[model samples]
Target: MFGPWWKLGVDTTLLAFEAQAVIGLRLAKLAAGGSAAQVEAQRMVSEKVLAAGEAAMQIATGASTGAVVAGYRRKVLANHRRLSRAPKGAAKP
Candidate 1:
């Protein structure tokens, strides 16, 4: 049950990490070809924005995965309960 969720979480984290790395590379490009001072300032701002974006992505991904797992568990449990309560050795009308 939880195995699938763990796998999904790991895959999500990896994807997010890759996306952040791509963004970091693009930011580096954008921060390039400027006066030393200007480049430094822009680099600082880019770093902050990139960090914030990565953090937000992680949080959102985690929350969404948790919600999906919770919903699935709830559904499975409900079905199990329903089956447990069903009469045995009876024919359907």
Candidate 2:
């Protein structure tokens, strides 16, 4: 439950840090290169890395949201079950 949520956050943060490191390395390579082709390749690699990071973040966010929703749904269902088990004074219209 809450454990999974915390794990997800930690996992996502680690992924993001890795992605940033990759992008930084690519940038450094691009800066150290003398040829235009090398620079262009590095730029492409950086773009791909950033795109992957964005996708990963999106997936993590979606998972977190789904977990929260599911937890809320479970709580609501439990409350409903409790209410149903109580004695009612009047019948529903």
lDDT of 1 at 42: 72
Please give, for residues 17-69, the per-residue lDDT of candidate 1 as tens digits: 65455455445544664574376467657765765675567567775655544
The runs of at least 3 residues in candidate 1 whose Cα sits more than 4 Å from the true structure, single-residue gaps closed, are 33-93
Looking at model 1, report the run of 10 residues with the lowest lDDT sum. 75-84
lDDT of each: 0.55, 0.55
TM-score to true structure, per model? 0.33, 0.40
Per residue, candidate 2 scores C-alpha lDDT tens digits across 1-93 of 698778767655655565455456546646766684385576566755765575567567774554544443443344344434424565556
Q: Who wins the TM-score comparison?
A: 2
Clash number for each model:
0, 0
Q: What are the clashing pairs of model 2?
A: none
